[model samples]
Target: MKTTFVSLALFLAVVAQMVASMAVITNPVSSTKGKGGKKLSVVWNDDGKSPKISDWGGVNVFLAVGSQNVQYKLQQLGSNLPVTQTKGSWKVDPSIGANSKSYFIRMEGTKLGSDGNPPMAFSARFELSNMSGQFNSTVQNAANGKEGAAPSSSTTGSSGSSSTSSASSSSTSSTGLSGAASSSKSSSASSSSSTTSGVAPIYLNSALVTVGAIAAGVAAFV
Candidate 1:
C-alpha cells in the first residue's frame, strides 16, 4: 500500500510539472513608448523549472511583427535593451502619417529549445494592433461573427485587445452604413438569421498604429 501511494504521488507531480512547463503567456512588450509602435516583448519559461524570470538565463527569442518578413532577434530582457532603444516605432515607413491607411502592428513569437537552435515552435494569431497610436481596432466576437461586441482596455492592448471604444463606434457606423447601402434588403427572417450566425467571430488585424507624436508627424510626409 505504501509503495502504491508513493508511485501515485510521483505520477501526479510529473503531470503537474508538465502542465506548468507548457504554460505560455504572450503579452504586449511594455516600454516608455506612448503606444502606437510595432515593438513588443516576448517572455517565456523555456525550461520546465520556473525560476524567477531574472534567473531564466540567456535564451535567444525571435520576434516577428505580424505578417512582415522582418524578424528582430531579441537576446535580453527589457533592461538589456539599448538605453536609447527606438521605443514604439512601427515597421512601416515613418513617413506615413496617422491618416495614412497602412499603419498597423501584429504579434508573433518563437521559443528556443535545448538544442540551441532557432525557434522550435511558434505562436498563433494571438494579438493585433491598429497602430492608430490610439489602439482602436475592431475585434470580432469569438462566440459570433459579429464585430465590436467584446469589451477591451487600453492597457490590455498587449493582451489581445483592440482599442475597445473605437471598435464599438466603428462597429456601429459599419452596421449603419451597411444597412443604408442595402437596396435589395433580405426578408427579416433571413436578416435575423444572418445576424445571429455572425454574432462573435474572430477579430482580424487590418489597421495600423501610428508611432508617437514625433514619428506620426513624420509619417505625414512619407
Candidate 2:
C-alpha cells in the first residue's frame, strides 16, 4: 500500500509540471521596452525540455493591444520564423503609437506541444512611448502586413473602419430596396385582378340589357 501511494504522488507531480511549462519571454519584461524605428531583440526560452519550441516547424511574432485582450491588431513583426532560433529582431513603427502600460508581445508556434496545442508565449506589458523618429514606411509595411504580414486585411488598412462600416450599410440598403420593389409589384397585381374580374362583368350585363330593349321596340312596330 505504501509503494502504491508513492507512485501515484510522483505521477501527479510530473503531470502538474508539464502543464506549467510554456514558451518563456525573457525580454520586454517590465524592464525591457520598445523604441520606435530602433532594432530590438525578441527573445524566448529554450529550456531543452521535451518538445522544445526550437524544433517547431515555424513561428510568428506579433504585437497585441492589451496584455489580456486583442487590440489594433496591427500586423506580424516576423513571419515563418525558425523556432530553432529563440531570438529575432524587430523595430516598432513610429507612426503606430504605443505608450500605455497595456500593450503586449506574443510568439506563436505552428507545431503542437505536449499539451496537443501549438506553443505560444506572451510578454508582460511594455512601453513604446518615446519613438526614435518619424514614421518608417518600410518597417511599418512589414509589420502592418502591406508587404506580406496582412495580419488582417482590416488591420492592413486600419483607417476608417469606414470600409467595413460601408459594407454593412450597403447590405442594409439592398434589403430595403428589395422589399420596396416586391411591395410595388404586389400592389400592381391586385389592381389588375380587380379590373379584370369585377368591373368587366358589370359592363357586359349593361350591354345585353340595351340590346333586348331595342328588339322589343322593333317587334311592337311590326
Candidate 3:
C-alpha cells in the first residue's frame, strides 16, 4: 500500500505540471475586407497561463490604393503605444477611392516583450484588383509553424481593379480589453481558424487539475 501511494503521488504531481504547461499557449485569428469597404477582426487568448501582458500581439495593417497608401495601427485596447493585448480590430478611414483599380493589403504582427512592448513577429501581404464588389481575407500567425491560407473572395475584378461602388461611413470604438470598427461593403465573407501546436485545450488542463486534486486527497486518506 505504501508503494502504491508513492506511485500515485508521483502521477498526480506529473499531471499537475502537465496541466500548468498546457495553459500558456494560444492561437491567433484575423479577418479583413477591402473592396466596397475596409474592416479587420483580431482574436487571441485572453485567459492563459503565460504572462497576461504577452497573451496577445499587436497588429499593423496597411492598404495601398493606386498611388495612395493608408496605414492602420491596432494596439491593445487601453494600453499605450506598442499595444500588444489579447484582442482588437480596425476599420479603414476616408475610404479607398472607388475608381481605384489595384490595391495592396499588408498585415504585420508583433509579439509583446517582458516590458509589454511589441516586437516584430510575422507579416503577410496581398494584392487585389478588379474586385467584384466586396472581399474577405483571413490569416493565421506564424506561431502555428504552418503558412496560413491566402485571402479569397467570391467576386472577381478585371485588369487587377475592382469596380465596387463607394463605401459608406466609418466608425471606431474600443472597450478596455477589445475593440472594433465599422465600414460598409457587400460580398461573401471568409474565415480561418488556427490552433497552437503541442498545446492542449483549457478544459483538458482543468480536468487534469481536478484529477490531481482528487489524487492528492486520496493520498492523504491512505
Candidate 4:
C-alpha cells in the first residue's frame, strides 16, 4: 500500500523533470557576451520521457530575436544537431547588431508544431558587441534551413598570389629565340630571377649558311 504510493510519486517526479528539459538551452544564460570572430559553445539539453529525443531525430540551432509580439530569426548556427548530444560550436558574425541585447539562441526540434514548423525553444535574451568579451535579427521572408557559411581563409602565396589552402603550384615559361639563322649575336647571360622556374633557351652565333652553300656549289663543279 505505502510502497505503491511512493512509487507513483517518484514516477511523477521523473516525468516532470523530463518535461522541463524537452529542449532547454543551457549556455549564454542571459548574460553571455559574444563578439565578431569569437567562437561560442552552443549547448542545450533535452529528455523525452514519452516521445523521446530520438523520436524527433535532430534539432536545428538558430540565432534569433524576440519581442513581446513576435520572434525574428537571424542566422542558423547549425543544422541537424543531435537532440541528446546538444552541443555545437558557433562563431559570432560581425554583421550582426552592435552592442545588441535582444538576441537569443533557438533550438528547434524536427517535430512539427501547430504552425507547420518545427517546435522551437529559446534561451534567455543575450547581448552581442563589436568589442571583445561582450555578451553576444530580422524576420526572414522565408524560413531558410541553410546553415551559415564558414569564415573565408586566405594564405600568402608567391608573386602576389593568395591561396586559401596550402597547395603546391608551379609555372614554367620558355622564351625561345626564333630565326636562329638570322641572329647575329647571342648573350651568354641567363634570364633574370623569375617568379616561376623555367628552362632558358641557349643560342649560339649564327651559322654561315651562305658560305656553306658556296662551298657545296664549287665541289659540284670540280
| Best-matching candidate per TM-score | 4
Which one wins by TM-score: 2 or 3?
2
TM-score-sorted candidate list, best first: 4, 2, 3, 1
The residue-level lDDT of candidate 3 at 30 comes to: 18
True lDDT of residue 156, candidate 1 = 8
Which 10-residue window of candidate 4 scores lowest in summed lDDT? 154-163
Candidate 2, residue 44: the lDDT equals 69
For model 2, residues 1-222, the per-residue Cα lDDT tens digits are 011111333333323433444455666554556666676677766555554666556886765431111123233577879767777778765433334443456565666544343444555545676542211222233223332212211010000000011111111111121001000111233232111000000000111111111111110000
> What are the per-residue Cα lDDT tens digits for candidate 1 across 1-222?
011111333333433332333212223222222122354444332333342222223322222121111111111123232212223322321111122222122221222222221111122222333322111222212211132121111110111111111212211112221101101222345331111110111122212111121121111000
Candidate 3 positional error at 220, Å: 50
Report backbone clashes per prediction: 25, 1, 9, 10
| Candidate 3: clashing residue pairs, number | 9
Off by over 4 Å in 3: 1-33, 45-84, 94-118, 126-222
Error of 2 at 179 (Å): 36
lDDT of 4 by residue, 36-137 (tens): 668777766543444455645577666654232122334567778666676888986544323456556656566653223344445655667762211111
| Candidate 1 lowest-lDDT run of ten | 213-222
What's every prediction's RMSD, in angstroms? Answer: 17.3, 34.7, 20.4, 34.2
lDDT of 3: 0.23
Candidate 2 or 1, higher TM-score:
2
Per-residue lDDT, model 3, residue 69, is 11
